[model samples]
Target: MIGKQLKPNFIFEASWEVCNKVGGIYTVLSSRAQTLLKEYGNKLIFLGPDVWQGKNNPDFIEDKKLLKNWREAAAKEGVNVRIGRWQVEGKPIAVLVDFQPFFEQRNSIYRTVWQNFGVQSDKAYGDYDEASMFSYAAARFVEIIYLSLIHKNKKVVYQAHEWMAGLGMLHLCKAAPSIATIFTTHATSIGRSITSNNKQLYKYFHGYNGDQMAEELHMDAKHSVEKQSAHFADCFTTVSTFTDKECAQLLEKSADVILPNGFDNAIVPKGSAFTAKRKAARKNLLRVASALLSEELFDSTMIVSTSGRNDFRCKGFDVFLQAMANLNSELQRQSTENCKTSVLALIEVPCWMKEPRKDLQQRLAEKEIPNTALPNPYLTHELYNEGEDAILNTMRSLSLMNDRNNPVKVILLPCYLDGEDGIINKPYYEVLLANDLCIYPSYYEPWGYTPLEACAFKIPCITTDLSGFGQWVDATLKHRGMIENGVEVLHRNDDNYFDVAQNICNTTIKVLNANKTIRNKMRKNAAALADKAQWNNFIKYYYQAYNFALSKKLK
Candidate 1:
């Protein structure tokens, strides 16, 4: 039986993205980490894969003094763990586990899991084996920590993010019963698979059976692990109401807690500092564009960007490119000076790339940019899969070749912007701060952090109703969101490709044509919206979830 609300004395969170910076989950955990540290202090422990086993990971600094006894104990059991502090806004204790040795024993582990929790991984492919092995090792690490250090009576909780970490929670269910478990599926594998495969998710959501869909889509292993984890975990949570529904239908389980993603304002620039950064960012962006495109650009040039995972249809890269094409065509036909003020749309999505463009790097290094445009002037980097890339292919189809006369010049910055990419040499956030407008027209987003981040930086954004953030904005405004102030939540469904493209074109033009005074107000309004979504305001939900899990006293 559950008692009154109780706080967990200790928490161990496992995610594939602990020291890894692969996807949005990294953003989710990293941004909230500081606030979480404030709440739990050193009692919080984050476990991640030891992907950087040999080389140094700048994000993690191992402290031999910290958790010395536990490391020794774990090592004795063939578990190699490096206890360190993650270098982010909040320096929380992290353990990077080396699961390489455990790979040999995966078959036995999977067999036992199949017998106990019905987790089937026979057909698992690609990263599934690696992730399962990592999770299994993470769970083993937690078990060691609990047995060797943690008290029997102390309230404890273990939270796993995504299906990649599901095996760990399931492992803990059998190995460590005293510790409460929480499994969070950011997006159900089957649901995302369905969307990416061009099947209508919303229209036929109710009729689809998750298990049937899993087998049909060949996502049985992922769906199986995730589904079992939901049933096995003591408490289940999701990042948004949108995903909560997806979990309900696609995974056959709804979240016990809806912990919406939030931002930490501590990382964001403030007041006059913000102004200086924004101006500097804009200047740097325009300067780079001028060097690459060989075009004279003014301060009036609006820098717009769209960034996320390079899931072509899922992230709406196709629609965004098509919209840019449409907008370019419209602006070319117009005579006004405002139309002549070029819109520089940057595609910040990362992909399989060789390196920074050698010619672009040379141009950037010069004291003065050459008057002539470089070959493939639209690309910030050369790609290994130049002919096979979806975004580049779509751009070719739409003829967004960044011609000098085009009013909208599109540049694809196809590498991760971590300030050391040889060109641009600025982090995504730094480059983002300079944007006059941000467009994240996602077709399938659980909780859109990009738009929220854009708003937090006082940049106006255009999102769609399908995104959880966009839905929240619409609800906050008491109607469908519009560009009159900060966000514009355009209505998007599976069938309206060109219609959505035209709408994006229209909304972006409105922002480009806006005067300085109107634009400033828009920026303020965007930040005001962001203010309501800080971790300080949203962290309560996480605490509540912890308390609920603690009260259960799963032991």
Candidate 2:
């Protein structure tokens, strides 16, 4: 029988990036936690790695006790258990299994995996312990719950995020065959790993080797973990419809439903009055840009912005940079009259890892290549030297390039943002208010959140046709080509870099040059779009998936 939680309306959530900060998963849990809490009350238990707690914290106390108990119990089963908890925005979350084991052992799990097999092409795929930690923590938590309910049994709907958490779900399922389970893969390792490794980019993760080293590690185990989570879960849900399709294909199983990710509108300030805040933000951006370029802003300036973790090649940051560079170059070549506009791009990419060892070598190599070489089909980074050169030049160009036509200024800001921080200091929305257009040229986005954020602020945005947001725009704007001229979609493979760059330039120019009458119409349409994308609509699907899973378990 599917093991039941001993309580009513309980949710057991496990994510690698929960209480510990990581990627977009943290955003999802933070924003969506309220909804879950409202629905399930005290019964919802969030689990993740507690990466940032210390000895004096109250959470450390509970974690030490929990970890001690679990470690003692699991010794009989030849496994280790590290556990902890902390409050993020006042949410009770479990940091499962201490990281000391993995760190102290020098990630022996990875060593063993490497010893067994050759490296694989995808670095993200090869890590074996990510899933093991997930499974261990999950099983430990389940064991705790099971023990708690020895006298009075309750039911739980265990939902796991990505492959890391999938391990826990798998162990839980095996231990209690009849308990309902749900799996949500915010993004897949295979697709992203392919993009990173094939391109030879590994700055995001420290000590990540391209496919060869990955092949040596046990990638298959994690793949199996993900596949089994799909196969075993009573219902499977993904962040976007496109992601759902990708996961089904990857897992070789059909998904039960699509529960698209949503942001808390509360985080975003309301009305155009936020306009004054934006203007101030723009002024601050100009100051930073001016300092970087060692020049003051003169004449009409248009700010363009994009924000995310830095995976420039895949995220289309490279494309946007190229477009801005090309536009600046063209404007410089033109007569003074033609070069009336100045553009600055404020880019904030949150990089997680510190520079060290092999990671440093890769970073330095990427900095050696010139920006001009990246767009050349013939000069693409296929050869090792070419790739290394391209990366180096990009870095050099990032540090020391300013254009006369449009001086594209890039900013690398932190990913973690809270409201108390001045709105002007927050990279994304601050730039959106002052900027003319936001660019997202993703090659493999399941759902693009930035575009939606841009739309919410009534700012024009450019996203590629491959993104789920772009597809939605296509469907929504069958008759209306430009959606009030606030957002535009570009095809990634439509033409060469020159053509793509020109399109981005032309689109941004068109939006900015349009009269006030057109701009007002666009803002109205933009707000309407944001209103339609409420979290309630998205969460309904999740509820339905849970209901379906519960019914299956009962049967």
Candidate 3:
């Protein structure tokens, strides 16, 4: 019952994260670039905001010769751009547009958008103005490229990501009706606002009105544009079935397709290389931990970690800390029987850090594991506002101090792991390889990438059913729980905070007590699950999305 596949002759993709390494969308675009390049080659043009103008952008390489004709034409139309190749796999063509000039016309542009698509921008704030200008400029760039370079007989598709690029999609719909448009919302704005504001999204999901919620949340501008784009785009899509349902309820538009995020497995090391890197990672992680805690951690010590943006409650940092406390209590009770199970749990989430702890730096420099603890042994970096910090307050409340004799020692690394974050001095993936287990217990994760990345590295992870990835894993593994199947999909709901914490504690204990054969099987199963989620397998949904958009254009 498969239908004929329709492909665009030329494709133009615009996103705020195109050349910028900001969050999960960058992974989606960068990881999948090679596959698109193999199929479309130079005809697939990526339009991004020129946020790194005049700077040495490591992710971008400007080549004046690549699109000279288009550059000249665009200049004549007042569209300043830098044509180059993105420094990812496949080195696809990119156009970083200077969106600053369009800000002068922001009011008129907003008026036009409202007139055409009913996107209310009057109450817009924060990044609304900046994102809208970039979107308008991107749309203008697409229009110029289509008219000057692309022939009239050819079919073209413009795909925009998130509300940040929704304005551009709306623009193309009005200016270039012949060109098909696809808008993908990774997470709905209202949904995120609802969750972040400590409101009950799932319990009141049906009763809440999108417009009223947006107005109440002061998210009218972003939500309006996102909803309008979904209604107007030739095809609307989202990253997961969870978000698909969110769109249906919040945006009042069903997604034309579900475009799940996929990772590039080629980035992962294989065979002995993987073994070597993992060993190195473990050594480095333990070395840092030992330096900070003043204790030498050996091969028997279990290294567990959870990392993401500092959405303490939403990313389940609260549950993670609670689980750690519970685990510590369990370990303490077991220690009475002379049973030693050392666990080094790391919280690698980024926060507003003033700098690395000077005492920890001095300890690392001495290259000697001290017998005594440093000040605030739980934190690697000093926070800007320690008194108001949620994680610190929670740790204190739970009495989960990073005691030297405590079997479960927690370390807070509140900085990005870019190989220069003083303490770790290693990149994220490099350090990730060292972990025995990773956990991302998200309360509102649309498409969880951390778990996917962990699985790709052959690391077993725990994620809740509230996440899109967790739901997918549940379906894939037929509801076989964690440790045994690599990914443990715990059933989480709004009211089960303590219950979820207990489950996480129990699961961690189970993994820690697992035999070598069982752990190896779990790792193997995790890797197998990750292989199924590679770009090669998941890119078909995108192809379906493109075909849907093209069919709409033809219609």
Best candidate according to lDDT? 3
What lDDT score is found at residue 435 in candidate 2? 63
Give one digit per residue, the lDDT tens place, for model 1 in 1-555.
224567888989999999899988998899999988886899989999999977979899999999999898889888999999999987999999999999899999999999999998987988999999999999998898788888888888999999999998899888988888888888889888998998898888889899999899889899999999998888899988988988988788889999888998888888899889888888888888888888768888888999998888888888899999999999988855544538999999998989988888788788887778998878888899999998888888988888766889998989999898888888888899999899999999999999999999989999998899999898778898787769999999878989999999999889888999989889889988999899988988887788767656644
Give the clashing pairs for model 3: 482-488
Q: By lDDT, highest first, what's the ranking? A: 3, 1, 2
Q: Candidate 2, 64: how far from true, in Å?
A: 12
lDDT of 3 by residue, 96-185 (tens): 999999888898999999999999999998999999999999899889978888899898999999999999889989898999999999
Per-candidate TM equals 0.97, 0.75, 0.97
Q: Per-residue alpha-carbon lDDT of model 2 for 1-555, expressed as tens digits?
A: 113323336677777776655566776776676666667755666776645445343333355664455456554544444454445433554545554444344345334433433211133433455545554555555666555442234566788888777755765666676567898876666546656544432223223432333244345555655666677787887777776666655556667877777655656666666877777777766654443343465425777777765676667766776676666565567545634336666665554413212322232244232233112211111223433443335634744244333334444333334322222244455556776667887766767788887777777778877677777777667733363556677776524556766788777666656777886787667666665665655666667777777777667
Q: Each model's number of backbone clashes?
A: 0, 32, 1
TM-score of 1: 0.97
Better of 2 and 3 by TM-score: 3
* Regions more than 4 Å wrong, model 1: 1-4, 336-341
- Candidate 3 has a TM-score of 0.97
Instruction: Candidate 3: list runs displaced more than 4 Å.
Output: 1-3, 337-341
